[model samples]
Target: MNTPQLTESIKSLVDNIDREYILLPEFQRDFVWEIRKTCDLFDSLVRNIFIGSIIYGKPTFEITVREIDRRPRKGEGSRRKLKVISLEKNEINHKLQISNFRLILDGQQRVTSIYRALKGIDEIWYVAKNEDELSDEIKSKELRDRTLEEMLYEFSLQEDPDRLSIKLADAFEISKGIIPDDIREQYFEKLSFIAGMDEAEIKENFKRYYTICIKLGELFNSEVLISYYLLNMDNEKFALFFERSNSKGIQLNFIDILAAKLYKGFNLRDKIDELKDKYHPNNLDREIIVRTIAYLVSDGKDIDRNYILTNLNYNHFNRYWDEVCELYNKVLNFLFNENFIISQSWMPYENMVIPLIIYLRESEQKDFSQMTEWQYEFIKYWYWATIFSQRYSSGSNEAIIQDANVLKSITKGEKITDRVFFSRLKSQIDSYEDIYSYSKKVNVIYKGILNLINYDAKGLSDWNNSSKLTPDKKLEDHHIFPKDYIKQQFKNDDQALSLMDCVANRTLIPKITNIKVGKKPPSQYLTELKNSNSKLDITLKEHLIPNEIIEGLYDEFFTDFLEERSKLLFELIKRNVIDKEKSIIKEYYQAPKVKGNIKIFATYYSKKVEATFDIESQKILFLGESHSVPSATNKAKFYLTGRNNTSTNGWRFWKFIDENGEEKYIDELRKLSRK
Candidate 1:
């Protein structure tokens, strides 16, 4: 409720002006005044001064000043307030007071420009002289040395009179119409106007404007008032205000704010840049990375969009940033080596899969550097396949996290050995082929691994063989259809087998180099494989079937592989059987039976009715009825209809009324029943 303002001459406005008053907050925008618009304001002021027009009421030039109030309080908590003051009216006295305040909700640029001009820091367009055009004497001369008549004449003309005869003649002609009542009197008067003006005039104007017009309202208590003002303004006008009023108009983006919160207490921007440079150098979309990190860190917490967009606080950003950086580093280190040759896709399945890696490393007592080449390859394949396979991608983050925890528990430590993880992973990969067709695959695989691990640990030893390992574990999920290749090849068939380009079919290899192999057959990478590692023994490994396998060929290959792996897995399960009662025996297995029933209703007119029923097996039964309509004479016609058993694969029966007045049964109905 406190109100204070000050107004002094123009001299005070310029001399006392502080750069801080012109600065917008970090949340504000940039300077956006067009050059032409600024030039126009300068030209108008100069022309009005040259015409000797009386400087009347303030020429509607106003500016809103905003300052952060961080003064210490008497209470326990530190309170931060924003003060907005406007400069509106020019008062009679030179004394500094609040009534001299002007309404400057915006327009900081115009006021600043005027203040600059009065201080001689800014050259009025008409008075500005080109260095090359001006004589040395005229350029170096002080304003006091110039004659009053000459100065007035120079001001009247739009050209510099001291430069050339052409400009001097122009000044003379322009001033010819101005009858000098008293040249000395006018000169003294103008000099007084310039000298009497003080720097405090502008400062006081700015202060009063800020204090009375803007800060005087309950703006410190309610931010909504300012927000409403901004919203009501037109886009261009508001944009201008945002530019000038906001310190340099550097508004933080939603992602920027979220990043700040996510990386709170840390240099989040730097961390993000570092990760991008280290892992995704070519993909510079920092916003996407930030969003992904935020999503991951939120861990299913409900977040408001407005909080992300507007209310992001610096402290929260710092904290979130630290956690994010730590997580990002862990992920990068696990997925890629220091050399940066290997990069993993961020598929949803990897959400659970990567955690398993951490669990494995911890359980196996192996740092990333100590992992065998084969172990790395196996883990990488499992992680990539699980992610891109679409099996776990559509699930909620909680579901994915839960599944990951389950995987970690199953694969951690000695349990991470080949036989256990691969068998489980292979089943998961196969399930991707027919998500619905192989609905039980994941559960089956999960159970199978648990079963095997529970029984004989040696059964899984073969998977631990170093000979089975590949180098660097840097395999990408190479699609046979080559996503792009498939898009081009199969334009019309949405359900075409090409759509089955999932982890089940995907295998890891060298990154971009493998992409060059495209949709080519496996033979294409054979040369590169030989060159990179001589120990690699390429063979007709049933699992290494060529990519050229068409739909018909794929079915056979898939079936064979499924059966072979299944047999190997089944043996492992048998060997590991801790509980013989729980073992799945072939002899005890039975196919499930289909069960349900259907019934039909028929209506008949009946004064008197006759009924007959026939029994079939326990699964079915039939009933027949006959009724006669009332007649005046001794005879009346009877109608008959029958309801029969309609159980699935059950028997059926039929009965109908004859055309005779007397009811009679027909064996033809029974024959028709069978048909």
Candidate 2:
């Protein structure tokens, strides 16, 4: 039996990372932690908060993978790229000793996070305070809620040792160069300081404070404790350990684990990546593919984890891979035809694709039109109803089982009457007012609705040129009343400001048009449009724009104008597509109070704020204040924009939860909240 080894310093781990002695396994998921979370992790380290241990393993055979340089992503908040500095090949091989490097099984997030921050690749900072002067806020327990920006000042390092000492002293506001003589030799040796008479204090409080303030370099010192398990084993045992080790931090996802285990000389992840590059549809996650294959083999009775794991053979995967890919192609085509112009953002519910794929596979129909009229109507009704009602918002596996049964029966030539379809359905959208805007583009009914409007847009660019809305074609959602105009009209009315987000104010236009139309009143843009195109009136009418607003008559009364247009848009959809059905009594599902560690990110008015829930205490520390769910939301808002008594929904305001699995939103948890 081989024993695992533990390394006890972050500096050592980082040194290993710098020299390329550590390499991420190909099966490791992409670094998906939001920039804000990265900042919080740094804060934890500076405050000496216990982030869990890391795990690593040395494989028996060699494998090749590139070191993940923390490439800067859009809106990452960090100005610096957290990617590691390049090292010479000789240095890498020499430091590594062995021919192959160790694979980080766990703590990739932590390692990369620290590397990014300390290397200044990620722009993050800790609050600096002089021990002598402490504000009331800093003294209180609530001070912990303050963000790094709120509490810390950004500074630069000096190369000259004496100058650096003076720079540090000035930053810390050490006036008169006051220093206790007894501790001067230990704390102030490299620079000059005034004697504070005969001071024989050991563990001097001021010295300790200055030490922490000037210890930013220690992040690279290899002294901060970081425990990791290093295992050396054969590929089979290593793969098994890889799949089932269940090492605490950053556990592998199902696909990640499955990919680590080779199936007939092919890794599932590589095959999926190849499929993704080939097919490239929005919302095509590995889990979705696994579920589709799982359902295909089980005949829709199960999409269980064990079922997927056991059935992921090359032969099984190869047999169903192309067909599953074709089914997804069909799904996107059907959505495109419906004017959903399928992008990940425009997709209302990914699981909604499952039953349709099951129906297509069972019915042997390549397209919806190939289905019997009754069958086509049956599946269409189910798709829309499931989306509008959000029937699977909770991601209940049983719901997929039940929904698939209904579609399979339809494929069997059992007529799905409106009564039957409506029976399983739960909600109806009588008007566009039912839709709401969220910080994220995914998982919103409004996104689906926007695609529907795009369908009616008929691919006409704002300039009246032929434009096809596709994944490649950039389309922008233009505000009918520009935000500035709305703000001017409504001032501080929260309800009215929120109206700016309503579907009524938005229309699909080409990205160029959206940019050019900036802040122009609808009438002014329309006037310009009429000058350029003979059919401006026809284009506006087709887009569901009310004639009065386009004609420049009711431009000033935009509030009433938006309300009337929403009704008009609702009527347009009803007149074209929908059949009468009663709305379901919508039930909300709250995420069970997270049982373990959880991190939440909230965005308000384009600024991001983060909070962490202490599982044991059931308290969330937001912006520096510890509180319950309700107060966290309020505090997050205050920290984000510094406004209080502002109307906001905690459910909607606090957007994302970075639990171990798929990112979930508080809004979804609310709608899916158990009774």
Please provide TM-scores, in order, for all candidate models, with all chains considered together. 0.28, 0.48
| Residue range 292-346, candidate 2, lDDT tens digits | 8888777666786556665556666777877887787787777766665545555
Among all windows of 10 consecutive residues in model 2, the one with the lowest summed lDDT is 156-165
In the range 219-332, model 1's lDDT, one tens digit per residue, is 112212112132454322333333333346575445554454555455657766776666543333444334333344454231223324344355555555544444445555
Q: Count the backbone clashes (under 3 Å) in each candidate.
A: 50, 18
The C-alpha RMSD in Å for every predicted model, in order, reads 36.0, 21.2
Candidate 1, residue 356: the lDDT equals 45
The residue ranges of model 2 lying beyond 4 angstroms of the native Cα positions read 1-252, 280-284, 304-307, 342-345, 365-367, 416-421, 428-433, 436-440, 455-463, 466-468, 572-579, 582-675
Give the Cα-based TM-score of candidate 2 against the true structure: 0.48
Error of 2 at 339 (Å): 2.7
Misplaced by over 4 Å in model 1 are 1-271, 274-312, 335-342, 346-505, 511-675
